[model samples]
Target: MAVRKKKKDRRYSKGCNNQALLPRGSKGWPMIGESFEYFGAGWKGHPEKFLHDRMSKFSSLVFRTSLMLEDVAVLCGPQGNKFLFSNEKKLMQPWLPTTIAKIFPSSQETFNSGNSKFRKLLINVLKTEALQQFVPIIGDVAQQYFESKWKGKKEIMAYELAKTFTFELACKILLNIYDPELIKYLFGPFEAIGKGFLSIPIDFPMTPYRRAINAAKFIRKELVAIAKQRKIDLNEGKATPTQDILSRFIVYRDENGEFPGEDEIADQIQGLLIGGYENMSTTCAALVQFLAELPEIYHGVYNEQTEIAKCKAPGEQLEWSDLSKMNYSWKVAREVIRLTQPSQGYRQVMTDFMYEGYSIPKGWKVYWTALSTHKNPELFPEPEKFDPSRFEGNGPEPYTFVPFGGGAHLCPGKEYARLAILVFIHHLVTKFKWEKINADERIVYNPLPHPAKGLPIRIYPHIS
Candidate 1:
């Protein structure tokens, strides 16, 4: 493998005056064997603090660590971020999918194929007409979920419930499958796939990595079957092609008059499944937790829902048009996503790069912690405080509020995720009143960051 050659005589800016230039390492190990020690456990637990400390000490940061794994460089401050994400071809690649592919080998191929097709398919299916059709479906699904799950005096884990909700919603929209048992089986494999993304590359049996590989295989098989059946139905004229995304994808032909193969279709489906659920689940749990902690925000959200309800009759469901009118609910959801970014964005440098007078070698793994950007006191005042109203007037700087990431590789399903969250909040606020069972419950940020103590909130039917 070719290593990134260090550049000579780089110029430094005033902002980076105190930055430290990274040193070179031996052929085998980078950072002279100290790479793992600094970037491993400490970085994981308190990433922001660790990065900040390094920024203050070093004029520029670089790590010559293990060549077996990519070398990681921490780019601190706003100017550093702009330079990194802007160079799309040189520094950007899907690091999360690469991590996942370590366990599920098939995932790498799936991701590569899906990236090519997602832009076309998303533009076609996520428009106003398609979203309008989905409004009723989403409303019905949410209502049914609440009725069955939150009925009676029962304590539930918010994270777990959010996971189930996301799974069901993804199934209804993506594959158009609605069978309960089938949905349960599909969700299990999908969850395993997510776990595999963060697991070590070892494929030993009983390990999370092995299970993730198996789950990927299982999901691909199911997707192939579904695609084949949909194609058959389209050919036989047994089904009318409606506005569903799957149906559109089945018939979509490219410029060369070619449709995607089974593997390609499956890959896109997998990406949608992963993108659809994980972040949304974390955001949903955080929104509920935030509402519980701040009654004023909660009441404001409730009033927004109430106003939305008043727009129609008492029993009427919300429409897409009503979404614009519910600005407060939308702001609350955006703030929650901004604050509780589920995953830190990771990108691998495809070529040797220069930023802020420092050398960032090719094949190095670069990470942007959303917490660092989102919680920056300069961008957001009183960064530790959970105030949704901060976004009420002028929101944070561009690219600063990157909970779903940014740039060309920005999540295509962002609209869908936001819609699902808003719809979920609307239901909870209008249909039920909830209070935290434990005021001091701690939120766990591991395994995709959710309420550690299950966000135990008792729900009662709202009294008009």
Candidate 2:
């Protein structure tokens, strides 16, 4: 892949010609060089300020440095996202390659092996039918956690609790791993692998990158063992190959009637661990924060749950059929995801592309910041306000409000994520009434966006 370079123009060295491109930063650094000191200080913490500075300096320009070996382009407004996301073939792969690749190395190979077989397997398993089977399991797991861990608690760390819950749920659904002790052991390496993904990819001794590599190795070993055991069980007929996500993958046959080997299965499982849990857990925690701040929304969700409770028999559990009646809850959940843009859409331009009279040279890192696009006043009026009503009549543009991204690379497990979040919220609202113990709680986006402080809330059980 050849790196794109900006053509020098001595006429506009001091200032930008286009007002639309003003507010960008200076293109002083060499191509592929790192301003590590500034980046390490906190690039994500102050995104708005950073973007403003960059925009002021360059004015719709891409800055490149050889030291860092990456191109940085600040995509602003709705048109920018459309041009980038709509052209999936030209710009499909994400920008955080090192981090993402480190987390799911096997998936990378599977992805490179022509058709994304692992991604297809994930879609087959996590789609509408496959996910329905896990609802009961997810609900039971959440209820147990709430009963055992959060009983009689006035306040709790929302992020930590959400992470633990989603992690356990993901393990059960993806790998069929249910042992608590083993989960604890596995989670440590998983966390390390996640950390390695975002850090500078240097394999020096005692570095985060090296630790992440070791963690990835440990995860692969564990998953390979599990896959082997699963295969043995399937061969022995000890386990009736049910329609779980992993089982579906195990039985999946390609054009040649070939199933993926254990290593490939391990890669997909690792992909689910990193890609599935972090985003959903953050969304879950953020949903709590949104509800805490907006009492009306909170009440609306509770009322939906109440209505569902009435439709059920004395002790009937909530099922997929019941989700239809919870319209308001679903809207609120969608709004939460829309407002809290957990991840950015990243891609590299494979060839020169033109948009709005500007040329996006090949090999440049082109990205669509979901935060900026989702906050577009044209698409989302009062963009900062938490209004679920915006999606009432006709929703925003198709590619504009993409929380799971767009095109063929759209998240395979999006449906599973939605169900898990809905179930968790339903349980929270049905079981207790919560009020924010701390009035001033904010979200922090690092590794992934999450509530900076554990959302501490006072919960009182509903008395009917």
- Per-prediction TM-score: 0.86, 0.85
Error of 2 at 344 (Å): 2.0
Which parts of model 2 are misplaced by more than 4 Å? 1-68, 74-76, 90-96, 99-107, 111-115, 200-206
Per-residue lDDT of model 2, residues 264-305, tens digit only:
778777777877788888788888889878999999999888
- lDDT per residue as tens, model 1, 276-331: 88888878888878887888999999988888787787567878888887788888
Estimate candidate 2's alpha-carbon lDDT, on a 0 to 1 scale.
0.69
Whole-model lDDT for model 1 versus the true structure? 0.70
Model 1 scores a TM of 0.86
What is the lDDT for 229 in model 1? Answer: 89
What candidate 1 gets wrong by more than 4 Å, as runs, is 1-47, 59-68, 96-99, 110-114, 127-129
